[model samples]
Target: MAETSITSPHIMQIVGYKNTGKSTLIAALTRSLTFAGRKVAVIKHDGHDHFEMDHEGTDSYSFAQAGADAVVVMSEKRTALIERQAIPLEDMIKYLSRYDWILIEGYKQAPYPKLVMVREEKDLSLMETLQDAVGIVSWLEHDKSESMKDSEGLVRHSVHEAEDIARWLVSLECHEEKRRL
Candidate 1:
């Protein structure tokens, strides 16, 4: 049998501490990007040893309990899969490369183009620990503050301003596309 595939890693990540609006920002960005005709794939970190897609007693979960290696639930509108395996981030990223943009929600330590979210004084130093940071999204009351002054050399955007962030990400994907060509 022949396998088919398509992937274009216009990859970027949104990293930050818990409750820092990473998920909110990603949801807004995904809505905006998809509305603008871009295919965006998102992978979220569960921050645990196990991740569950279906609730117990559901048909899919029952299949897994029966020792099925994979369970796929599909409807005319959408499809989801619950599988058992461990794949490295690099391999997973490559597997999902068949999209115009790949936006990651965690794995802060991974080396990739990132939009690091900063929300508190203590999180200020978190940015410095990130790799390949393209921009910082500030969730502070004021966009500029003494605490954030040390975060030099990265573009800053307000967390509440989701459209602006989405626009910036779209441009990043375009820039990467040119570089890839």
Candidate 2:
């Protein structure tokens, strides 16, 4: 994979095949980053053709079923908008640029700085095709050997080290901020 510049420094992606703990890692990162006083937003890619958000008996569900193009529900503390169409990732990122960190889950082919999850030896092949991979989160203990060095400056971390990974991501954000200054 060719080296790619970080176009959006606040964006970082966690990508891996199914059952590779990508969601778990992203959840951990969100909690840690939030506790550290950073505003974080997450965008997840669902490969499935359909996903359910509103329950069948809910008002939102009825509105959608009535062919409403968009349904937005708001309360004192939270708001959610469901559009009938798929929004492109770039547009979503632009809309969420106000957040201090946008930790994306999935979208493996995106050129953002990413931490690839490797569950086994075969999973390491993803590094060959993914662009701008900054690190690796491995599930297997011995998979951190030299054979895993698919790119220069790629750091390796165990799946258990969520706090360490969070710290690493925070440091990267700080470094990028400094570079921009």
Q: Estimate each model's TM-score.
A: 0.86, 0.91
Q: Which candidate leads the pack in TM-score?
A: 2
Q: Please, what are the lDDT tens digits per residue for candidate 2 over residues 19-126? A: 999999999999998888778899989988577888899999999999999999999999999998989999999888778789999998888999999898888888
Please write out the lDDT profile of model 1 over residues 88-140, one tens digit for every residue: 88888887777767889999888888888888867878876778887878877
Counting clashing residue pairs in each candidate, in order, gives 4, 0
lDDT of 2 at 168: 83
Clashing pairs in 1: 6-98, 7-97, 7-98, 8-97
Candidate 2: misplaced stretches above 4 Å? 1-9
Best by lDDT: 2
- Candidate 1 C-alpha error for residue 29, in Å: 0.6
